[model samples]
Each structure stands twice: as C-alpha cells, then as structure tokens.
Target: MIIRKATHTDIPSLVILMNNFRKFYQQESNTEEVKSFLKERMDKGNSVIFVAILEDKLVGYTQLFPSFSTIKLEKIWILNDLFISEKFRGLGVASQLLTRVLKFSQETHRHQVWLLTGNDNKSAQHLYRKIGFTNTKFKHYVYNF
Candidate 1:
C-alpha cells in the first residue's frame, strides 16, 4: 500500500470515492460538482489530499483544509473528509491516510489537526481514538446559508 499526495490525474478516482462518501453521509452525490470542487482546490493549492493506492488502485483518501487558530496564533488543519472504499475497509487504509495527515501537519509546523464525524459513527470514533485523537469538549455550531 502506498499513501501519497494527490495530483490532477487522481481526480477521477477521487470523485468516485467522494461520491460514495457523500452518500454515506446521506447527501446527494454529484460527480461533476465533486470533481470540479477538487480540481479547484488542487489548482489553487487551497487544500491537501492524501490518497491510498494498492496495486495501482485508488482505494481511500483524506482531505485537509488549511485554517488558523487565533487563540494559538498558529496554523491548523481541518480534516474535513476521510473515506475508504467498502471493499478495503478492514485493511487499515484509513489509518494509513490519517497517519500521513498527522505527519504532514507536523512537518509543516501546524498547531493541530481536527475533524468532525457524525455522533452515530461509532466505528469512525473508535478509529480516531485509537489513532490518538481525543474528543473535544466544545460544541459545534453551523448555520447553513
């Protein structure tokens, strides 16, 4: 298994996984929109995406968005998306992707890495805790436009 940063050529595979991820979250899947979104981010260098490849097949991916912590006066990474293909679920692909994220964060001197998951996603929660992420006490608030 190889985990590495994504390039433009990886978009098709990414779109497939991203669509599946959206469906997993009960959201509508739009391949063109997802591909365009990822392309824009990659073109603008606005986010970091790591993909897991096994024998030339893209099986998993995790995306991080750059942000800052005013309180800490430092940069942080918001791990906004993570997904492993259904057939590759039990093979530690997600863990490998996460490990790459953490290593990237540290190498880039970021203050921290954080992510949000559905409250009902016990499996994800378990994987996160196992990977050394702690649950934050703060509540999340969002206002959709």
Candidate 2:
C-alpha cells in the first residue's frame, strides 16, 4: 500500500470516500459539495488530506483541518474525517491513514490531533485505541441548529 498527501486530481476519490463517511453517520447528502469545497481548502492550504492506495486504487482517506489551540497555545489539527471503503475494512487501511497523520503531526511539531466518532462505533473506537488515541473525560455535544 502507498500512502501520500492528496492533490487536486485526487478529489473524485476523496469525495467518494467522504460521501461514504457521511453515510456511515446516517447522513443522506451526496458528494455534491465536495469538489469545490475541497478545492478551496487545498488551494488555500487550510487542510490536509492523505490517502491510502493499493495497486493504484484509493481505498482509504483521512482529512484534517488546521486550527489553533488557545489552551495549548499552539496550532493543532482536527482529524475531521476518516474513511476506508467497506471492501478494504480489514486490510489495515485505516491504521495506515492515521499513522500518516500521526507522523505528520510529530514531524510538524503540532500540539495535538483530535477526532470523534459515533458512540456506537465500537470497531472504530477499538481502532482508535490501537492507534494510541484515548477516550477523553469530557463529552462531545453538537447542536445542528
């Protein structure tokens, strides 16, 4: 498997995975906004995307958004999205994509990386733990209004 940063040319595959990610969350939206949305982020260097390719096919991806941490007084990243195609689930693709981000954070001296998943996603929780991520004492709540 090959792991690398995403380019504009990779948008189609990225959009596909992102749409799947949303579906996994029980959202019904399509990839309608992905192309232009990702283009803007990529063009401005506001986010980072990494993909896992096996035999020239994309099977997984991780998207991270950069933000500052007032508490830590430094820049941090929110690994806002991660997805591995259903067909590639057990192939360690998720681990590979996450490891790339972990390495990238360390190399760049970032303060931290954060991500959240559904409470019922036991498998992903296990994977997160295996990757050195721990459960926080605080709860996450979102209001979509």
By TM-score, the best candidate is 1
Model 2 scores a C-alpha lDDT of: 0.89
Taking all chains together, each candidate's TM-score versus the true structure is 0.97, 0.94
User: Per-residue lDDT for 66-116 in model 2, tens only?
Assistant: 888887899888999989999889989999889899999988889799999
- lDDT by residue (1-145, candidate 1, tens digit) is 9999999999999999999999999999899999999999999999999999996899999999999989789999999999999999989999999999999999999979989999999999999999999987889999999
Q: Alpha carbon lDDT of residue 139, candidate 1?
A: 95
User: Which segments of model 2 are wrong by more than 4 Å?
Assistant: none
Colliding residue pairs in candidate 2: none
Using lDDT, give the best candidate's number. 1
Clashes of each: 0, 0
- Looking at candidate 1, what is the lDDT of residue 102? 95
